[model samples]
Target: MESMLIEKSIQGDVASFEQLIVKYNRYVYNIAFRMMGNEEDAKDMSQEALIKAFKAIGQFKREANFSTWLYRITINVCKDEMRKRKEHVLSYDVENQDEGSMKENIKDESTNPILIYEQLELKETIETALNKLSEDSKAVVVLKDLLGYSYEEIGTILDIPVGTVRSRLNRSRSALKSILQVQLAEQ
Candidate 1:
C-alpha cells in the first residue's frame, strides 16, 4: 500500500502524496519540534520539509525507505534554519504543544503533583543539555534515543556509517549524562 502511494506520488499524484503525509505527519512534526524547540518554527519547518519532499519526489530512489528519506529532509530543513539563525539553545515547548501531540507520549503517567513537577524539571534539564550539543551530535541522539530509530536506520538517514552513528550516539549520551549530573547536583 505504501509502495503504491509512493509510486503514484512520484508520478505527481497529489492525492497519493497526501496519503503519505497523513501517515508520516506526526513523525515529521515531532522531529521538527524537537529540533526547533518551538511550536511555530516546527510547523513552518515541517511544512517546508513536506513541500521539499513533494517537489523532489522524483529524485527519491525506490530502494530507500521513504520515511528515512523524509526524515533526512526534515532534519536538513531544521539544521538549515538553525544555521541561519545561529542558535543552538533549544528549550522544551511542552506548554505550547496541543493535547494528544508527541508531548503526551513523554508525559508521566503519575498524577502526583510532586512527580509531575520533578518530571518537568528533568525534561527541561535534558532539553538544555540537548541544546548544547552540536547539530550532528544532536541529530544522532534524537534519531537514536528520542525517536527510537535503529543504528542502521540512523546511518541510512544521516548518510553515515553505522559505526559513526554508534560513536556519535555514545558521545552525545555521555555529554548529556555529564550535563545532567552537574545540573542535578547544583539543584
Candidate 2:
C-alpha cells in the first residue's frame, strides 16, 4: 500500500501526497517531539521534514523502509533546528509532557508527597542530564534507548557506522550515569 502511494506521489498526484502525510504525520511529529522535547518545535520540524521529503521524493530509491528514510529526514531537520537555537537546554514544555515510562516504574499505591517530590526531582535531573549531552550523543541516546531502535537501525538513520552507534551509546550512557550520580549527591 505504501509503495503504491509513494509511486503515485512521486508521479505528482497531490491526493497521494496528502495520503502519505495523513498516514505518517503523527509518527514524524512524535519523533520530533522526542528529539526536541516540545510540541511547538516538534510540529515545526515534522512539517518541515514532510515538505523536504516531498520535494525529494524523486530521489528516494525505496531501498530502506519509508519510515526509516522519513526518520532520517526528521532527525536532520531537528538537528538543524537545534543548531539555530544555540541552546544546551531542551525547552521541555511541561504542559505537553507525558508521564512516560519512568512514571510507571516510580508509581505505587501510595501517593505520598515525599515520594512525589522525589520522583519529580529525579525526572528533572534525568532531563537535565539528557539536555546537557552534545546533540549527536543526545540523538543517539534518544534513538537507541527511548525509541528502541537497534544499533544497526540507528546507524542507518543517523548515517553512521554500527560501531559508531555502539560507541556513542556507550558514551552517552556513561555520561548520563555520571551526571545522575553527581546530581543525586548534590541533593
* Best-matching candidate per TM-score: 1
Local accuracy of candidate 1 as per-residue lDDT tens digits, 61-85: 9899999999999999999998888
lDDT of each: 0.79, 0.76
Indicate which candidate wins on lDDT: 1
lDDT of 2 at 93: 27
Residue 67, model 2: Cα distance from true site in angstroms: 1.0
Give all TM-scores, in the order shown: 0.79, 0.75
- Model 2 residue 62 CA deviation (Å) reads 1.5
lDDT of 2 by residue, 1-187 (tens): 8889999989988789888778678878877877777788889899999989998888887898787788899989988988888665553222233425334433442443334447778777777677666667778888888778899899998999999999878867766655555455456
Model 2 lDDT on a 0 to 1 scale: 0.76
